[model samples]
Target: MEQLFSHGISDSISDSIPQQLYRPEQVRHMEAEAAARAGVDMWTLMQRAGAAGWTCLEQHASAEDQIAVLCGPGNNGGDGYIVAALAKEAGWQVRLFASAEPKTTDAQRALQQWLDADGEVEPLLDWPESEPDWIVDALLGTGIDSDLRGDIRECVEGVNEAKLSVLALDIPTGLHGDTGCALGDAIIADHTVTFVAVKRGLCTGAATAYRGKLWFADLGIQREFRLLTEPAAWHLQQDQLGQWLSPRPAHSHKGQHGHVLIVGGSQGMAGAVRLAGTAALRAGAGKVTVICEPGQEFLVGQQAELMVLGLEPEDPRVAELIEQATVFAMGPGLGRQDWGQRWWNWYLQGLERSDPQLELPTVLDADALNWLAESALELSSRNHWVLTPHPGEASRLLDCDGSDIEANRWLAAQTLQEQFGGVVVLKGAGSLICGSEGTAVSPFGCAAMASAGMGDVLTGMISALMGQAGALNITTEDSVRAAVMAHGLAGEAAAQALRPGTSRGLLASDLFPWIVHWINPNDS
Candidate 1:
């Protein structure tokens, strides 16, 4: 086997895994699953991993160029040894640097294979005459703890300083595959050729920055691995939305799509609810009503699709609208003052009318969450609601610092769900959706969504989905998840509209057409 592979990376590789994302422990366990299956073993998987990395390198680097291979003590490092030997055979200048001796038996066997191929492993103390054109980071993979220290820390720093293009084998060394958080300092790769399933962390937050262009190669265990375990979190894709969407027949009417009552857009903040209402229309809401302060009705009137109704806080129509509403999208422009405060109190106070079976699926956003946080209530009753809050709002709701909320977004989402019943969409770089079903993290989105009215747009989108899904008797979490996926894709499309270098000026309205594309499968 060693003699046959000494010629360099061959085209004999496995299928690609683009959809499924896994936690570190999950992927490791799946490796065992793959090894346990017939005609494959741990060493075979490791060799395939090495070949995968080598193929990625050949695609990115010149054949005549020098390559710096950083190897560790674990099987991750063993993969490095094989990659080094393969690169050398492929006729590149392969300079192998070893931080430690091979630890596990499989790693030991892989090390011997490199020696048989006459490849030498050098210590970092010795410097090569010329800098390598590419660096292969095979050190310290997913198994490492949060504390990135000792020789590994120094090695990571060296790689980052070299600032050269790097191809990280499964994940960039020092990045917690489970959390995608950099445990201290991590390698910044130009591209990461990951094996098996994708580590969930690579799709969001700080971990996302280090992995430049991610490509996946499943190593022939895609089906077996999937059969062995479920994913920790789903990376939302456009395709997933199709199952969640119920097609409307030619006989379908506007009343059947479900009505959406968006309650907010207080005085001086009318555009907030307008954006939400527009988003609901784009998301296939049969009818959207924007109920705001008396002077704010004109704000929603600009959009001819939305029906704007202005009312005083104590108006009888408030309860009437709530009764007639299919779903309520609350808190887009809701302020904490008298006008916004009164309406919030009305919704909270009025929710008591419905039993759980007939309760409205409400999307609680912006100041509605603030009102909840300020009320000192445990939210013991509102089981049919979705709270969408950014990190700052999440901090307020959870009573923790914003930093704590940002530290572990999934944990924050779970804590919020525990505190406030119903779905909690912890919106940010990687927005998390936590509910009774489980948690789903939004994998696609841009920093562009950080602009002023983005959340308002999402509020409308998800609420419309929830209302529409209610007509079809679909699950609330499913509707919410689909909305999040659609919003993210829309945001990405809006961002792409800008010139290549810049990611600015993407407005909430820019996502309207894209939302239509996501909702309608035929259009997509």
Candidate 2:
């Protein structure tokens, strides 16, 4: 959204990486031509890439450090050769391994340069007896997506067994450059220094395990590269918060912020609606009302701020409150029983009868998404809602297996938004938000977020932000992004405080204070 670093960028992209994310093919097709337009050739760009890789290697190594470099047969291998030669010149003990002899002219020249520098290459099968301080993976950069095979697969296996900290250049070998899925096997790197541009693969899906602590080096062609192509998606940034939220006017009242109506908290699952309601309050909703089963009021309304009305589907008060609500957050603990089903139908009928131009802003999550999938009701013309679904829910909505959704999350998110009008938040490791404004990925969440009730909290946060969109002076898409970012930041903060380096015991409610902290971007 707001590109604070957009202005006054330094010559090197490393100083300020652009938020734009590109598919690997975009970089591959445009990079050479873009470099030429910028008055640089492909070989020179390779050298700069090698130098950048050398710099990253230096961060994890020192002179005399034993570093093993794995080179491929193409340009990726050429970059590896250049890095090995520079390491040798810097007095580092370099052990270079190649799956095959350099094939391309540029790679052939690079190999000769390394030979002239007196560096020897070993066969791929020669596993080093001695462990090195760091292993440099320069093999298979954005080249393959089918599956790993032959010596390359064996090499990937060997490197993984070594378990040394790895610095992967461009991308981890075997990771699909576009889908982020492993071809067959992928190198697990501790740090990956991607060159030219940030590949969409590096930020989400299975790549999360193989590509760790990502670093980007634009290789001086980013300006030209960006001019050559448009980004397919955006990597979420904290600075984007400033673009979505601001301080409230000093004389503002609670009613001015907007009201959020939270539906569904069946018998034993009243906690879901409670969590959603409380999260709405914590996230700055002016007022929150939880509509649950007739007897769950005490459990749902225990939080003083939440006005809980435990009523049946036919209760007239339900219609009255629904009419007054500025936004609706449906699902959460809404069960699949007759009671929950009746409420679902009630809401659907209201939406069906409402004017298309003035449809209330809504958030569909948890059991609500499940019910929506079951109903198969098409609301493709309404664009005032948000659907937040996990892989399972998305799979249900798309009529596919959950693994298919995870295999290519970008496609899943896009398809969901296309099939179901309005924003779609595909929640997981690299949560993706797709809408009319294009897709954005929030890479800020933690594994601790794997627990239950997290999605409910996110539903509440989204609803709160949506209700406040008018006052915040941002679009519905901006509101969704802001809520997702804040939710992720809160989870990260809570996980760090509770378990430091591991994600073990963080709870859904633990994020309340942090949600308040992040929701108010100006204060933080």
Candidate 3:
């Protein structure tokens, strides 16, 4: 049966937006320049921002509900003042709390306007008596260069204690727009209305926990801003998948799709190779072969579509098979035992000594990665290979602690790419695929893919795509990016369809049909 789950964007919304993502600093300057270019004053843009924020609040809050708008010392506080006045005019019980007076001209003007409109501004030193239905966090914007201390921290603590549904303006106060690190104390918002462009920080790590249900408000300047500054990064949108996917030719045959060879699965590990080989076939590999332990020949043969190659535990024929195949996937379920280690070493030596004339696209994962890391192989020079390492493996390869790798995932991926050269897929919640040019992150996959054997399936899928596309002359980097996106999308589909908390039951084998379904859903 074909898998029904795959991640994709609707046709209508796919082509409308560009994938350009910016750093917080770049976005702020871009917003200012864009506002100017639009013949709108900066204050006018701030007003629109506040209005947008108020509109968001109205959408989520009831008309009679009491709300507190927390303001800081800068323009972010100015936005709070505007929201407070808007809420007051709308007949809602609203109170404005600020740690310090507004300092910027637009902020001062906004404060005067709020006071003129009979809005009450109170110091946030003491907690409000009555708990409100909502809290507007405008304490800090993207300009937070220093840590949050003194009254701001106290204010944040009070808001948390109030147990109100906090809606942060622009960004959650205290999140470094560039690093996504919290500045001492930060507000945990239920919803955040970011302007212009989404900051990269919000999509990764602890930031994802704080910024809930993120909404992007262009504030009517995205286009102008995009023209002025190049995006440092971008989020993967669903619609762009088709562009990277290979279109089938009317007269195309199995041979045209290219062949994939999977080399792994030591004794008692046949399931990993089976998952990978079947995944390759499902991913549209014209031919799939699994070179596993001779003891597991029957297990590999159970999959009718996959060709089982019964090789001795440490056969040199494995290298020959690699030479003949269009792509190779190694390390899934590969044990570190004496037999497995000997096979691994032979495979490595074969790869190193292979005819320079025969360069096949390869994927190295699991034990393959561990062996290479332990051996200190110069991986960067092997441009034909792709390394898929989860955080632990990546830490081992980089000779760093796992926590260090998790602390700065983006930089870690970048460092891996710089050091290792080939496309590196740093798999985790927000899986990052980094190449020489730049990095792309897929925030789509869920905890469902955390189950056993998922990585093995990913290895095969990537290998297959590389093989299929490389035969057509697609760049290795582009192929890796597309494969990573597709793999995550399939995992997301499985997560959505299966029972909650049952992701552990989602075998890597289940993703193959979903991959096909996603690439061409309407097909028979």
Candidate 4:
């Protein structure tokens, strides 16, 4: 199967906020309110909604195809009746399977309309007797509050057994619209055409399997409706990154950018430091210096344009260099040896005593993050820092099992941010960047970036962005937002250039050219 990323969706469409995300109850209320505001009858919205659904069906299926419309007792079933009527009118073979009689006036009227059109209406238990090209699930919508059992369970099982393409209305029946939790046996849809607003459950958790090929259609709601409700979550998109990236000027010089100092690389681990230093430079840092073990200085200088500083594993001069740099990238190859521990402790102490107004933004990764977690150092005091951790590292930092972290990546990222008092980048499939006020999930990037040294490059790239002269002038939130987006975009470009299967071999060093390429794609 072709990866979804290969679909080549441009940044423009991806940048648009998903039409609207609403809780199940909230959507029901919105429908009532929108109906009142439209100065039309309550049935008008349902009619329009069903019409929109039928339009989608027309586009998705052919006129000669046979479709089974499954209806329940509520307004959702009313929509299904309307869909059946439309499909019949379009000269398509359509059958109706009702789980129960219409309970609402609109639904009753729709059922009468279907009868008036001479459509087939039979019990849902008869689904096995009929053969249809597609199954339209309208058995339940956002209003489902109880577990699906009895006939509904058997109906769902029968639908699945048929192995026909299914289209769910609003939401897959028996899945919580607010929590993404499945209620008994939920219908697994191949396509879900949601109306008015998107349900939060559709985007996360186990709901991913049930709500496939998600599509949202707004029933002409005004944009001002958004002002009435607070957004519970946000999606990170590529164009949003433009707000954070610094637009370059023709006269801009390297000195006009900011300086970054990368501190790490214990004995025999020079490649990590080289990767970090080169990444920082590639990410647009004007000046970068690598302060590593004396034995690794030659290797650092050979691979990167960065100025390499030869220092003993526990050198005190490292503090002076750190104080001078606009941003610090720490960890990478920093080992767990006693010398590395001593240097790490001294670095934290330096951060504690550093001039409050002159403190530089620091990014902790790999060993530095592990040391912080082990020492239980009060990280909240170091407000200008970012922590990048994979699942194992995050589990240690949060004192939780790795399974706990994977179970809810968003919650884990938030917990780490609240505990550590810095931007927390939870590196994994669907990487999350959480801060004090908000969280952003990178929809790009793949398992291709799963190789060693990737986190080192990420730390360096973020540090460079934070240290950039333009970034220093922005708000802290803005700086962190830009850095996170840039890092993901660079990773995405690199992964795309080297096909998906070949991504594991991708090194942190490979990200540099791609970072430069993405930051200035037109720069030749």
> Please, what is the whole-model Cα lDDT of each candidate in the order they appear?
0.80, 0.86, 0.77, 0.74
Ranking by TM-score: 2, 1, 3, 4
293-350 per-residue lDDT for model 2 (tens digits): 8888899878998998888878878767877899988898999988799988886776
TM-scores for the candidates: 0.92, 0.95, 0.89, 0.79
Model 2: lDDT of residue 214? 85
Q: Give the candidates in order of lDDT, highest first.
A: 2, 1, 3, 4
* Residues 449-502 of candidate 4: C-alpha lDDT, one tens digit per residue: 778888778777887777773644665555656666666677777777777556
Candidates 2 and 3 compared: the better one by lDDT is 2
Candidate 4 TM-score to native: 0.79
Candidate 1 has which clashing residue pairs, if any?
none
- The sequence of per-residue lDDT tens digits that candidate 1 reaches over residues 77-96 is 98888888887776778888
Superior by lDDT: candidate 2 or candidate 4? 2
Clashes of 3: 1
Candidate 1 regions with alpha-carbon error over 4 angstroms: 4-19, 125-130, 351-358, 470-473
Off by over 4 Å in 2: 1-17, 354-358, 377-381
Cα lDDT tens digits for candidate 3, 275-368: 8888787777899988877678898779988888777645667656766788877888777876568767776666667655236777889998
Output the better candidate (2/4) by TM-score.
2
For every candidate, C-alpha RMSD to the true structure in Å: 2.8, 4.5, 6.8, 6.3
Highest lDDT scorer: 2
